[model samples]
Every structure is written in C-alpha cells, then in structure tokens.
Target: MLRSLCTPSLRLICKPTTRCRLYSTPAVPKKPNHALGVQNVKPWSELSTPQKVVVASKTTVNVGVILAGVALTGTIVYYIGSELFGSDSATSVFSDAVDKIRKHEELVAILGEPVKGHGEPSRNSRRRNRRITSQVVEDANNEPHMFMRFYVEGPENQGTVMLEMIKNEQKKWEYKQLYVDVPGQGLPSKRIYIERK
Candidate 1:
C-alpha cells in the first residue's frame, strides 16, 4: 500500500502541465516626433486685424495706467512737501518762532542755552515723529490765520510754545502772538510779542 501511494503521488508531481493564457502583455510606447509636435507661431504682420487691435489696445491701456499712477503719486508728494516744509507753510512759522525763542532774553535765561524744539512727545518710539499741531482758518475779516503749537527743551527745563500768524495784504505771514509757557518754574508765563499787529 505504501509503494502504491508513493508511485502515484511521484508521477503526478513530476508530470509537465501545458501553459494557459489569462492576461495579454502591454504594447511598447512609440518614440515622440519633435518636428511634428512643434507648433507654428504667426508673426506680427500675419496676425488678423482684430488681433492686432486687441494687442495694441491692451498695451496702450497698460501704459496709460502706469503713467496715471506715477502722475498721481508725484502730485501727492509735491502737495504734502509744500504744505509741510515750504517757506510759507506752518512748519516755517514754527521754525521762526523757535528761532525767536532762542534769542529772547527772558526765555533763554529760564530755559538755558541751546534750546531745541520738536513736536508732541509720545511713549512709543515709533510715534516720536509727531507732526506739529497747526491749523489754518479764516478770521471774521476773512483773513487767513495760522495757529501752531510745539514743545521746546533746554539744559535747564522744558516748555510749550504757542503762536499765531495772519496772512497780510501782500500775502506774507505776519506774527500776531508768540509765547512760551514753562510750568513749575515759579514765574508768570509772559507772552513774547514777536510782531504786534
């Protein structure tokens, strides 16, 4: 019985079986033809009238917008510069007032020599570039008047300076009032008359 079982199992194990197909093999990819795949771009002269017009209009609009933006930026900068740093602006008035204060015998004596003037003080360092407090308004006589205030400091003490000016018949700035107020200095704050109207 053992010989019979072994002989049959050995014959089945050693026998060759015919191959059967289940799935087909994938086809190889063809080489790309660069010359056939390339696209032909038309020249400017070959473009249609509508295409040329569209391109031209797009370029014109882009250039116009750029020029307009530049012009606007320049106008804004010029206006702001004239308003802030021009010879006839509020900043000019502030400079003149500070110069007068530096020369005044009373103020110089109280605040000490080499006095410096600046705008309002702030706790934040970035806000130190404060603008001068100023205003331009018309008076009852329809004459334009400018009012300004700023701070001044010296080796001895710090004080606040206030001033007012009017545009005269010649359109020139004329000082009406200028003064410095020093608190805790034990003296009356005297109004320094720069030029009496």
Candidate 2:
C-alpha cells in the first residue's frame, strides 16, 4: 500500500510496462494562431459592390445631415444675436420713453409749463432741499423727450416719479402717473409732468 501510494501515476495507468501510453488521454487540439500583434491584416473579405455602394450612401447621408445641422444651428445663433444686440432693439426702450412723452397730451401739458428755466423745482426746503433740472432731446424714434436731473438739498426729503404711457381710443398718447424722485439720493431722471396749481 505504501509502494502503491508512492507511485500514484503508475497505479493510475493500467500497466507499468505500457509506460502509460495506452492509458494516456488524447492531447488537446492546438489553438489556431491569432494575429493580435500583427497590423495591416485584412479584417474581412472585401465588400460586394452593392454593399460598398450602400456604405458610401450611408456615409454621404450622414455627412449631409451633419452639415445641415451645423447650418441650422449657425442660423439660429445669428438670428438671436442680431435680434438681441441690434441697434434697433437697443434703442427701442429709449425711443418708447420719448414716444410716450411726445404722444401723451397730458404729459405735454405738464412739462410745457413756464417755470423759470434756471429756477429749481418746487419742493420743500426744510425736509430736504431739492434742485430739479430738465432738458429736452429727441430719442431714437426721433420723438421729443425730456431728461431731468434732480439734486436733494436737504436731509429729510426723498422723491420719485412714476412715468407711463396711456393711449386713448384714438391712440393719442398721455402720461399716466406722477411720483417723486427721492430728495438728494440718486440722480433724478423724470419725464416732466406738471399740474396746474
């Protein structure tokens, strides 16, 4: 038993004289050689003419789609930039402001009043001294408008003015509201609105 254990390979074979040749299993088939490291090898047989034509057509279609997409994107970008930054859009608000003043009859009536051109605006002197100055100019729309600068001369005064445009049934313009520019705070800019005392 010790001898048999010592020579397990011999015991596994049918006979020692046979040298395990008769009992040995068949060798495994050799793996086919793969060219993992080789380069420039044909990966597949050449495509048939019809297959080639199909591939070419697909490539052409893909390129055309890509180009069309690029063109469309460029066009959209151009349109957005032009509309947003164009002079017309930039000037529209200023023009609208002027147009509102010019078209509104009430606004004209208010601003047209004869205050001494050099005199400060009528405001309380105790709370805060106020100096109101105005100038007329044409806006982008070529409409007459007024630019006002106000200085608050006292500590207690604050003011602001609300300016808006209102059109009548006939589309005639009017200034809709008036408010205060803070006394002596920010630079005052108001569309002139005058009320008869």
Candidate 3:
C-alpha cells in the first residue's frame, strides 16, 4: 500500500521528449515597433492638447445626441398617453352627453338666464360660476345615464332643477325625467313625463 502511494523513480521521469521543452520557455510580452508608424497608436493621456480636445469634443457630441434622442422619445410617449387617456374629446361618452345637454335649446335657455351677481365677478368678466353641474353613471340595465342639476336663481329663485337623460340604441339621448320644485312651495308643482313617439 505504501509503495503504491510513492512517486516513481527519477530514471523513469528523466526521459527526453518534446513535452519537456514546453515548460522550459518563459512567456515574454513583445514590444510594438515604432518604425511602422501606427497613426492612432498613442494613448489618449499621451495625446497632444489639440488631439485630446478633438476626441473629447466628439465624445461629448455623441453623448448629447443620445440624450436628446431619449428625451424626444419620452416627450412623444407622454403626449400620446395624455391625449389617449386624459382628453375630453367628442368621442368620449361623458363629453358627448355634456355637449348634447349644453346644445339643447330648452335647457340652455333656462340655465343661461342672467343672474344678478354673474357680471359682477372679476369686475364684469364673463367667467362666472356656471349654473350647471353634471355626472354620468350606469343604471341597473348597464345603460349610460346622465344626471344633472342646474341652479336657477332669478325672479322665481328656482333652487335646483334636476334632469335625468338616458342614451337610446340610435346613439341619441332622451330625457328620462325632470324635477323642478317651487322655491317657496315645499312640493314640486308638476311631474314631467317623457313619452317616445
């Protein structure tokens, strides 16, 4: 067992072969000859002042172009996202409902009544608090419905005029109901009925 673990004799190890010369050579780095004249061989740190400035300027311009391209792409993405999600365009359901209500001759004539303090805001500026406020919600039938209230304070002092409109299959809005209570009187004077022809 001891003989099996021991190294072989020097006579067996001393055999001459091509493999013996592999380890005899020492690795040495070859020096580059300056006589061939490599044009860009000089390190950046060893370059003349003008040469270094030219390299640095080119690097700065390339970096600037890359940064500008990223900024422009980011700006385009932000604008597209804003227009897609944030705009109240005519195609939007809520905006369509509001536009229809605003253009209604009957509703506009009622709400557009000139109030006493309306022109007084901002020293006769037209930017008065609007009389109408509205919201849209889906009913039990999953149909779009608009609920709106108008504050009409004139000679009659009409408090809050409630209007409810539902969208039909023809892409048109029809009034569902309307309620307007008399200012001094406790109960509504009349009930509005919406009957389709």
Candidate 4:
C-alpha cells in the first residue's frame, strides 16, 4: 500500500486530456453620428405656447410685486418724514391751522393786525394763475410761508389773508398774527388791534 501511494497509477496516467473554449460574436462598430454623443437643443422660439405663457405670467407677477413694494416703501417713508421733519411740512399743518382757527369764533376774534391790498391780488400770485389754467407750476418760490392759494368756485376766503399764529409748547397753534391781507365778504381789511382791557 505504501508503494502504490508513492507511485502514479497506470489507469490514471492512461486518461485522455480534454480542452474547453468560450466562443462569442464580435462587437459591431457604433454609428458615426452617435459616437460624438450630441444632444437635441431647442431654441426659445420653438417652445410650445403653454410653456411661453407660463414664463410670461411668472415674469409679470414678479415685476408687479416689486412695483407694489416700491410704492409701499415710498408711502411709509413719506409718513415718517412728515412727522420727523415737520418744518418743511408746514404747508399742511399751517393750512389746517388756518381752517380750524376760522371755524372758532373766539380764535377769530383774537386775530389782529390786518393787511390792506386791493388791486385784484396783483395778478402776482402764481397760485391764482396756475389754478385758473388748471395747471401746476412747480415753483416753491411762488408760494409764501404759511400761505395757501387755490381756486374754488364758491364763497370761500375770496381774498388773501395774512395770519400770525404760533404753535404752543404743547404743539397747539395759537393765533398770533391772524390778519387778512385781502379781506373776504367786503369786510374790513384791517381790524382794530383789540386790547384785553
């Protein structure tokens, strides 16, 4: 048994050798056009109508929102500026004070030192000219301090009035120099400076 294990067996050496091979079809060459891997690109004009509409609507909405934001920001700035810088905002405040003072009998009686001007307003008031023409003249120099001139077709203050008013420490306008430059209703242009007596 030791000799048989050490030596090769004659039956095993007589076996025939067999070889195995794998066969496959050759790969075909790719098309010349596909070799570069070009992609289809469409121009903007070639886009469908629905796609164009969607793009246009998006643009319009974005622009509208931006415009609305600008307007709102402007309004807020104006409000804040009017309050903070009340000096230049005298037109509204002074005009309103004039109106309020006129409505009060006690305050109107306190008005003193009237003005005398008779020549058809001198045709000098830019307000009178622009108002009659219904046109606006951007001339701040034309308007005087605390002076409001506008045209109305009713029996309002027909003539010019110069008023001397002072705002108290409490932000209240006190009638100081409330004199009419041009008196309305053919009333006296100059009023006697009333003494407290």
Strongest candidate by lDDT: 1
What TM-score goes with each of the models? Answer: 0.70, 0.30, 0.33, 0.28
lDDT of 2 by residue, 1-197 (tens): 11222232333433555443223345557565666554343323576777778878999999999999999999999988865665433223333444443454543443442211112555565643334444445667665444443322122332333333333456444444433333323555443443211
Instruction: Give the root-mean-square deviation of each candidate in angstroms.
Output: 12.6, 17.3, 19.6, 23.9
Residue ranges of candidate 2 with Cα displaced over 4 Å: 1-45, 90-190, 193-197
Sort by TM-score, top down from the best: 1, 3, 2, 4
How far residue 56's Cα lies from its native spot in candidate 4, in Å, is 23
> Model 1, which residues run further than 4 Å from truth?
1-41, 123-127
lDDT of candidate 1 over 1-197, digit per residue (tens): 11111331232222135433233345557665678986555798999999899888999999999999999999999999997898798777888888888888778877888999999887788775777899889978888988888998899988888888888778988888887878666776545554455
Which should have the higher lDDT, number 1 or number 2? 1
The better candidate by lDDT, 3 or 4, is 3
C-alpha lDDT of all candidate models, in order: 0.79, 0.44, 0.52, 0.44
For model 3, which pairs clash?
none
lDDT of 2: 0.44
lDDT by residue (71-137, candidate 3, tens digit) is 9999999877754565332124334344544454444444454422121124445567543456778
